[model samples]
Target: MSPAFNLETCARPNILALEPYRCARDDYKDDGSNVLLDANENAYGPPLADAVSLTSAAADAGLDLLGLHRYPDPHQGDLKEQLCALRNTHAHTAQTLTPANLFVGVGSDEAVDALLRCFCVPGRDRILVCPPTYGMYGVSAQVNDVGLVKVPLTPAPEFGIDVPAVLAALDAAVAAPDYDVKVVYLCSPGNPTGAALRKDDIAAVLGHATFNGIVVVDEAYVDFVADQRTASLAEWVLEWPNLVVMQTLSKAFGMAGIRLGAAFCAAPVARLLNALKAPYNIASPTSTLARSVLGPAGLAAMQANRAKLVAQRERLIEALPQIPGVGRLRGGTDSNFLLYEMLNSSGEPDNAVALAVYTKLAEQRGVVVRFRGKEHGCLGCLRITVGTEDEVSRFLEALAKTLAEVRQ
Candidate 1:
């Protein structure tokens, strides 16, 4: 008595039109020999001493071999407990966070996807984003059939969010009554931008009288920031129930391969994300490695590595502008990368010159950096990840040579 469903028509139209997120490896297939400064991965691998210590401890605790046969804990209580303790170090108030405030996922990408699913209804709800930021926010919105309202950051203030403009956009959406703005994504220590949004500006958005939606701040590169208070807003979750702060172990912990991310939010939102995620979302092997890196010894080693990377970032800032065809550096120096313009013979942004340098660096010199000229406000730009001392030296050499060849 039942009619058969047509799979093609059943598929959401928005998803049908969506293009997949192009990861670094998708564009350039690394044979493991190239100097990769394209993606914002830490050139220095995880701390060996702490890794060894963790392996020994896991072995003694009988957890080293357990992952092969058993499913990972659905609750991921142990890892959550460790994160809770670590986060309390910068607690905004005397109040401490518990596992109820946390949601663990494969990565922040999953958290972003889950939040949209939990809040936005297909073709009915909308989300707000500031441009020249993370690509995942827009990509996830497209996949979910949600409308995106963009209020680009004011270029004058060095890529700072235009809080008043965002408020006005939300009001306009409400007056029209066309779509409900269910979520707002903010990336601090932003990708490509390499800037941190001021705390007061973020609070202004969270405290908006008209917008009752959740504000998710992606702090993936927060670990690279020298000041912990400026770098993180996780503690603010207590004061602002609508706030959610997302972080990852991929950057500072050098565990991109592990694919673990954490979100700190109010209990209700955390519960919803958990409900929407796959039952066994975090794999056993991934959880084991995550726990090891989050343990006491591992935390200390991570801090040591962070100190080194921060130094390298500063060194790059000092030396990069000296190169030929390099123009003004944009945004704040909070993250592990820099976004600077590549100029031409006449000293203006030249996309052609930038592209040629990018191609030559990768193809001829085996040094790959990202060409971001196409992004909003990023004309003739190349976003380079801060690498090891040797890598930086090599990058400078290759860049100088490439610039000369391209200009000629």
Candidate 2:
């Protein structure tokens, strides 16, 4: 029989079919500093940096030491406590959604694996992915032994969410006798494509998944969204209990090196994800640095960087059409990247030609950009991230030269 909840109905019976991972309070709790015998850390590792150096050093000096002598917090208490303030959730009565409702991983990548491990059963469960989106979703699902259902977005429709197709897929899953759909994943300000799913579209998916399954909204690029319109289904997790909002500090915060991302969901979902994560997922230095970046001053600087990137993105879009062989510019409603197609004399789509142009600019002109072909629904396109004014100018110069050479 199909389960009562849509998420459960879509999951592997043996997986969502079972209780979530649970750890004893004492098991997760921290007990002072010395004699860390909990998770079997290396007896000796890198030495810790001085407090003074850690506090006011330049970026290079700040990241100098590892000090992996002791295992960092498994539950990530201090980091979560700090992020709670930054996220600014509603007031709680008994216990304001503690660190338990939060799971910090090496990056959003680990969190993706943890979530799949928690719910997916090998060879029985499947995940649905929208094309021209982040590839990690499909990759993680496959690595975890879960099936993948491809639902390509209609490029003709501005690559908007295929509401009807998604709804039909849900209907089909519900009709199946034994199949269970656990989670539906969506990426906003989606990668490569840079298309931001609308609020209404996200709400529709959330509402549909609420009764039967879980909806995971990946807001990895939310920080780059113009006007900050990216969905915050984080709070919805409190009310709906079936929503999981994942975010990363890699992009806007310029903390990609620190490698930290978070998953915000109801306490139950968070607990399950937390339990499935590695005991010591975060490093001591990473936790400390993440905390520092989430502070008021650091956050302001991050926002300023985002604004600069957006401006650069606009400039690129405006300039692309003027260049011959470039058909039309796409993407960048939200996010720092933009995509545009380059056509050959025959009017045929040729991403390889575009990639060659990209390489020439990078190798000969010293300008680097991402080359994302039409494989994931982005035919004959180039994905370029916004850089500084000087960098953008250099890119335009390099691009013009490459186009002239390609024409010849």
Candidate 3:
């Protein structure tokens, strides 16, 4: 006879002790939704004209329009092919990438989760992260029952990864008898920090002989980075088998609703992730829309939108410093957002003041931005996304009013 499963006893201990990730929407749910500058989603929606053109082309190409009833392609070959073409155009590499090198997921979050599941065994395995970075890496680790080793970024060097610290941490973990560090998560054009980790620094981590683990670089905002050279390190996957580059259509392509993310890695790792993920995770409509957006016309529209957003980002960088009580804008201006401190009467980062501004802006002024004071090294900081010109103006005006009112 087969043994009966006890739900409580069978549940993993680490997962049992996990605190779930608090999404932005969860905190600010239905307080009369206004300017959604939180969550770092692109304010601009997807390229409708391009989508229309592509859909028409797709119909003409005899694609099954009623395929919504069916499951999405398990491999998502068409989307992967388009992604490969896109990557090849931007950064040419001698080694060609096939659909075999790609793994498509519902979003980058899924990729993150899948990567952990594929590589790290529950409770015993560990992952390294540079904090004041993406929250999801830690959250995913917790959910998967994987130990997280944090080597915090040096606050001085614009939140760059501390290579030596990372090495030491990895070595220490390796020397320990129980835990095995299986994955290292690096967020390029980092979430709240907006800093791109140097390629050389990343290469050093990848080359670390002692820590034989997969290095997952989350380039969720790579397209927003002005410098193309520093923006993407996907091509490096060809050279480093242990490297995995994750990107999303949500940020740059303005397809958050569609929920498509790409993972570029060596074939074996890709296969493992594919094996671990739900067979029909990416829905048919989502795949269809994703493929349409990844088409040539859609790519052109995305580029145009990117150019506009970058211009808007530059404008914000120029204007934000002039606002009263706004202090140092920390981190590199590589992504669409800016991380700056809110100073109090003493010109120091005042958590209370920052919280007041954040609350007042959302509650009273109908403008929303992230309050990241609790993050490592991000004292009294607000991470604001680069919105439309009008939105930016509104935010600035709202900020000025909120600061004055709070001070009064």
Q: How well is each residue in 1-408 modelled by candidate 1, as lDDT tens digits?
A: 002212133223443344434445556666758777865645664344457777677678545542233334578888898877777755465577889899999898999998888777789889999998899999999998999999998792289889889989877876776777878899998888989888888888877776657889999998887777546777667767788899999898899997999999877667667766676789877887888889988889999888888888888888888888888887678888888888999999888988999999999999999998888888999889888888988999999889988877
| Candidates sorted by TM-score, best first | 2, 1, 3
Off by over 4 Å in 1: 1-63
Local lDDT at 78 for model 3:
81
lDDT of 3 by residue, 1-408 (tens): 002212233223444344434445556553545666765644554344456776677578545443333334566778788888767633525777888889999899899998887777787989899988899899999998899889889893289989999988878876999987878899998878999888888888888766657888999999887766536877667777788999999998999997899999877667666766676788877887888888887889999888888888888888878888888898778888899889998889888989999999999999999999888898989999988889988999999889888766
Off by over 4 Å in 3: 1-65, 89-92
Model 2 worst lDDT window (10 residues): 88-97
> If the candidates were sorted by their lDDT against the true structure, best first, what order would they fall in?
1, 3, 2
Clashing residue pairs in candidate 3 (N, C-alpha, C atoms within 3 angstroms):
none
- Report the C-alpha lDDT of model 2 over 186-300, residue by residue, as the tens digit: 8877777677777677666666732376778888887776555223445556655677778888988899998999988778677667656666678878887898888888888
Candidate number of the best TM-score: 2
Which of the predicted structures, 1 or 2, would earn the higher lDDT when compared with the native?
1
Against the reference, the lDDT scores of all candidates come to: 0.80, 0.71, 0.80
What would you estimate as the lDDT of candidate 2? 0.71
Residue 158's lDDT within candidate 2 is 68
Better of 2 and 3 by lDDT: 3
